[model samples]
Target chain A: MKTKNGMILSRYYTIADFEKEEAFLREQQRKGFQLKKFVLPCFYVFEACDPEDMVYRLDFAEVKKENKDSYIQIFTDCGWEYLFDVNGWSYFRKLADEADEDNEIFSDMESKIDLLGRVTKRRLVPLAFIFLCCILPQLVLQFTGMSSEHSETATFSTFFFWFFAAMFLVYSALFIEMGVGLNRLKRKYSKG
Target chain B: MEEKLKRVYVPMTETGFYILFCLQEEMHGYNIVQRVKDMTDGEIVISPGTMYGTLSKMEKDGLISFIREEEKRKIYQSTPLGTEILQLEVKRIERLYRNSKGETAVGK
Candidate 1:
């Protein structure tokens, strides 16, 4: 659950399906609690407000302090109320009008595809790389070191073994789940 | 006219095309969005994400250059390189238009 207002809700919005997160925020708006700010790793803070049809959208921009002002200004000029940006994800909302059924920040399929590419490039790829190069190597080392059979070294290796093993499984599941999700979304836009 | 840049942008996306087209006159990003919507009869609406991304990419690729900022909105204009690419794209579109004329174009 993302929100019901005043009470903070912690819901992890995976990078794979950001559209889902946007929908969730819109749903929250419909229910009368509007997102006030967001904290990393799944905390969405909301404030009680009159229920109104507000369209929420997310943009993946690694905006820096220098240009963030102008970046938000452009959206403001175009009529989007800039909520807050967390990490590289900028959240926005605007009153849903009569023809706002398909209201979007990016008007074309190619731009949508570009958004997907940015998410994959800036977030997913680097995370996947870390799991591949760093975690995978440690996993192998732990497995080999577990063979020492005695001393603090053996105990240390056993402890490290389980830790790496758990991390490996976590990384594997995340990689597969997000990888598939990204490919499916990309195909939907590319083929649609 | 680097072949690399042409390959990357010659067959410009609608978003790219309009951004370049609108920036032929120095204009704000949001203004360009509105202009494109008007020009296309509301067939397309450039979202802030797409607008920002295209403006940034075009500026980097030397297609659009920043002119100034007013009210915090960055103004942009097409560059010489951008104009060259746009002219090439116009020629391509002209060819497509002629083909769309179909059998009725036998006289022309």
Candidate 2:
């Protein structure tokens, strides 16, 4: 399709042309009519970004079919754009690569995952030490009959609470680390 | 070299396949987007950010190469390797269609 500016627009071209046409349409200051183009197998739908905002795209749709009626109907049903059969593979690859790049950019995700793993490991050491230092010694004293006839009772709930608390602390840390790792990997491989 | 072609699969991602698919018609980025939208009934969408990124990656991977930049938009075409991948994907999809038919129950 040819535009008023003498540019022969087609199914495939550069983004600059798309942006330029958008700008020209906006500069004319016409209200309601939108300047849309076929970027590939899709529609580069431009809408007013804001009242005073530069004319920009709100979203685009994959034009899998040549028919505008089908395209418009799908767009009306779901805000997401439809991809044409022709551009399906290319668009998928592009989406996947973008996800991969974004994953690489998340530097902090790696460290956060590592930090959580380390703390979880450390929590185990202190819990073990508590068992050896307090519980084990007390049990030994009771077994050896070192306690006086007037014995003080230790509740099972207290022991259960401490044991479970330590376990939960470690589990929580490990869980956080696992979550971070999965998220990072998802980002790294997040191809659409 | 033909055997090596088997190593590359048309990526499952829509953009990669769409880009390669459009190149079959010998088009550039903008045209590819239009063709894809037109073909897909507007179900699929590609943004400039995605278009540029995919084009660069495909060129790097030797799946597609730059033809030329006319009026600031770069053109791309499929390589021999890319063509092989597309053919393979076509075959795979065909098999998938056949297998799916077998799994579906016949109407009463």
> Per-prediction TM-score, chain A only?
0.92, 0.22
**Residue by residue across A1-192, what tens digits does model 2's lDDT show?**
334532333333222123344354454324433433335454443343222312332212322344244333322232223333322221111111333232121123322233233333454356557656766555555444433453343344445446655655665555465455545544543432
What overall lDDT, based on C-alpha atoms, would model 1 receive against the true structure? 0.84
Best by DockQ: 1
Write down the lDDT of every candidate, Cα atoms only: 0.84, 0.48
User: What is the per-residue lDDT of model 1 for residues B24-69, given as tens digits with 9 covering 90 to 100?
Assistant: 8999888997898899998878888888888888888898898888
TM-score of each: 0.92, 0.38
Question: By TM-score, who's the top model here?
Answer: 1
lDDT of 2 at A137: 58
DockQ value of candidate 1: 0.74
Off by over 4 Å in 2: A1-192, B1-11, B103-108
